[model samples]
Target: MSLLKGKQLTHYYFNTSNYTKALENISLSVEEGAFISLLGPSGCGKTTLLSILAGIIEPTFGKVTLNEKNVTETQSEMGYMLQQDYLFPWKKIIDNVLIGPKIRKTLDNQTIEKAKQLLKDIGLSSVIDAYPSSLSGGMRQRVALARTLITDPSLLLLDEPFSALDFQTKLKLEDLVSALLKQYHKTSILVTHDIGEAIAMSDQIYVMNANPGRIHQQFEVPIELRQLSPFDARKHAKYQHLFDRIWEELNQLESTSIG
Candidate 1:
């Protein structure tokens, strides 16, 4: 079943001098436990579309539905992880992961214990009580991942969560996140400018065009590639074929924009 659906989503940004159409008639559906990526050039409104789907902002002319109910009518349990960890420097790792439950007033023994297990699963058991400042960039992101998952969200919105890390860290996290999401059976959508990242981590990829951003193409990752971890997927023969195809499409989009 479709866990989340966006119907003809259109969005606009208004300013004192003028208004800009950020997105246009964008429609998409994500199945339960499927992973997808929004791949596009900058200014293509990938983030805008993600925001709308996350219920952080409403579409100017369309509606989003979760589990068949209008998003506005439902309490969205969707988790959002951004490029920056945005962890509270003052809070310990445990406190950082529990922030969501604390804000929702759902914190208790069960939630706290779950948070501990998540930290352990992510290889941060040694630093469960350490502050964010003491952790490395990659470690902080691990905490952020645990924070996002503590609420047990049915869907995860990942906005280039690994972009800020070093290449080695980014690759490791890609494999880690892919495994974790699959283990939990969570539906996820990632927004990234990296074509390789999209192909490596996604079951499906949507390439977007700019100038009133809209979907330009959709490609499904091969079943063999999808079964492997993101790192292993990159080494698959089919990966290069798909990557070149997306590169050509994106190159054409860039040329059109420049012209």
Candidate 2:
């Protein structure tokens, strides 16, 4: 059964007399434990769609059901990683990572032990006491990922989580995030403009178009299951083909927007 479903989602930004359609009839289902990526050109509704699904903002029209429960009126039952690392500067790394559980009042001793285990599992045990300001940009992002996973949500909503990092850091973190998600058996929906990143990280890619934003294409990757890192996925021949196709699609949209 699908873990999450979106039914005929439509969203718009309205003012006194202007109505800008951000999404129209957007619908998709995510299977349990599947890693899905939503790819789109700028001004497309990738973030907006994610927000709607995450219940950060309500859609003008639609329904979002997760694990067979309607949470459109409640706070999302999923963890969210914004484009920027939303870590607290003054909080120690462990404390910052525990924010989710703190808010939900689930940060008990057993959970704190699990939180420590999560940090250790991610190879950040040594930095557990360090503040966010003391860490490198990549380390901060790792902290962000740790923070999100500590909540142990069934679903994860990643909104360009690595957009702020350098290419090398981004690639490395992709491996880290992918492996962690697999280990935790969490289904994830990643929204990104970088087709290469999407191809490297996702089992399926949903291509979207803007200007009354809508899903334009959906591709179930045609590649053998490879037990390799995200860094290794980038080196696959299939990755190149998928990247080229998606790159071309996005470039076309950019050209049209320019003209």
* lDDT of prediction 2: 0.87
Clashing residue pairs in candidate 1, if any? none
Give the alpha carbon lDDT tens digit for every residue of 115-157 in model 2: 7898898888999899988998888889899899888788999
lDDT of each: 0.94, 0.87
User: What pairs collide in candidate 2?
Assistant: none
Q: Candidate 1: misplaced stretches above 4 Å?
A: none
TM-score between model 1 and native: 0.98
RMSD of 1: 0.9
Model 2 superposed RMSD (Cα): 1.8
Model 1 lDDT per residue over 1-259, tens place: 8989999999999999999999999999999999999999989999999989988898999989989988766544789999899999999999999999998899999999999999999999999999999999999999999999999998899999999999999999999999999999999999999999999999999999997999999999999999999999999999999999999999998998899
| TM-score list, all predictions | 0.98, 0.94
Count of clashes, each model: 0, 0
